[model samples]
Target: MKKWKAVLTALLATGMLTGCLGNGGGSTLNSESSRIYVTEEGTFQTATVESYVQQDYYNGDELKTFLEEAVSQYNGANGQNQVTLDSCTLDNGTAKMMFHYASPDALIGFTTQYEDKENQVESIAVDKLSEVYGQSESEGVTFIKADGKKADQKAVSKRGESQTVVVTSANPVTIQTQGRILFVSDNVVIKDSHTVQTTKGKSYIIFK
Candidate 1:
């Protein structure tokens, strides 16, 4: 099986659900879209779900084997254990799978192997917002607090230097990081204290 379709076939085959992207991860078992969990170390895991009517020829066991094999091959080629198939299951016309990667790039590399663009999610983690999104944009962008007030520049700057800023773009992804979220860009919608969602353009998550 092609590495690109590994994430797709596992989810879209059954038309189930999907996962997430960011320097974040979570234990959420079910999500309408992809939910990604990232650590301070940059390691991350994604839980994807897809659901569709089950066809008579669909064999859950065979699909699982094929997915595991693909994961093995990818890990072997990309460095042992760089990517792992944490789980894959198909039940009652729903498919759910989780993948663990050494880094967000590893996950991106695996999902976006196809050139034509399927399951293409790009994510990067930087120590500061200026590191990736640039100093000009970082300084100019206004982030909001959980209370819905604009984040002050002094506080944002104080934590900006030590914060982990995760910038990612995907098909409606939910991103969670281990650090406390301090601010987010206009494109980012705060889902919780540590989780956010972005649909258009690049989304930024600045956390301390």
Candidate 2:
């Protein structure tokens, strides 16, 4: 198999990591080494995996340790509701750490406090999926036709957004003035300035 590199995004980072790296640095949780290295600008804190010795393989132990460290650091530094690691999972060298925080503002505060320490946990999941799948497919962004004639009509995703519509007619199609044509099968034709262009002019345009 190919050598794979999994990148775990840090939804939480301790003040120590941020102090050194700035707020964009990351913490590396290594399963094989049973250790976590918190990196900031260019410095890091090397800690033994002692804090997570009893947890499962999915880096739950390491995640808990990180969260504890982060919360402690945040509380001591800012005296606020610190972030918590809600869940964790490890696959293909990537560690996924989910966290629960008060709000985006709180999240930003946490990030600012430990920014040199990294990206959110969602990116780790993204990396894992990217590694497992190798490639990705995306349907291009669609611009809605909200102001056109069919204002009330919604745009349905029929296959990819890049597809085009093809319209064909079997009979003498009538394009009415109001952009709508009612084809009366010889039953009724309430014509009030709504003209129907026919291929052949017939007397009894039998619109019963």
Top-lDDT candidate index: 1
C-alpha lDDT (0 to 100) for residue 156 of candidate 2? 25
Name the weakest run of 10 consecutive residues (lDDT summed) in model 2.
Answer: 120-129
lDDT of 2: 0.28
Model 2 per-residue lDDT tens digits across residues 88-199: 5544533444444544344445644544233211111101212321122131212222122221112222212221211112222121122122121122122322222222
In candidate 2 the C-alpha lDDT for residue 199 amounts to 24
Clashes of 2: 14
The top-ranked prediction according to TM-score is 1
RMSD of each: 5.0, 25.9
lDDT of 1 by residue, 1-208 (tens): 3443455555554434433333433434334455666666556776665655676666667667777887787777888887788887777876666778886678788766522122346765556654544553545666677555787766765664645555556465667666767787666788777777766556667776
What overall lDDT, based on C-alpha atoms, would model 1 receive against the true structure?
Answer: 0.63
Please give the CA lDDT of all the candidate structures: 0.63, 0.28
Once superposed on the true structure, which residue ranges of model 1 sit more than 4 Å away at CA?
A: 1-32, 114-119, 126-139, 160-162
Clashes of each: 23, 14
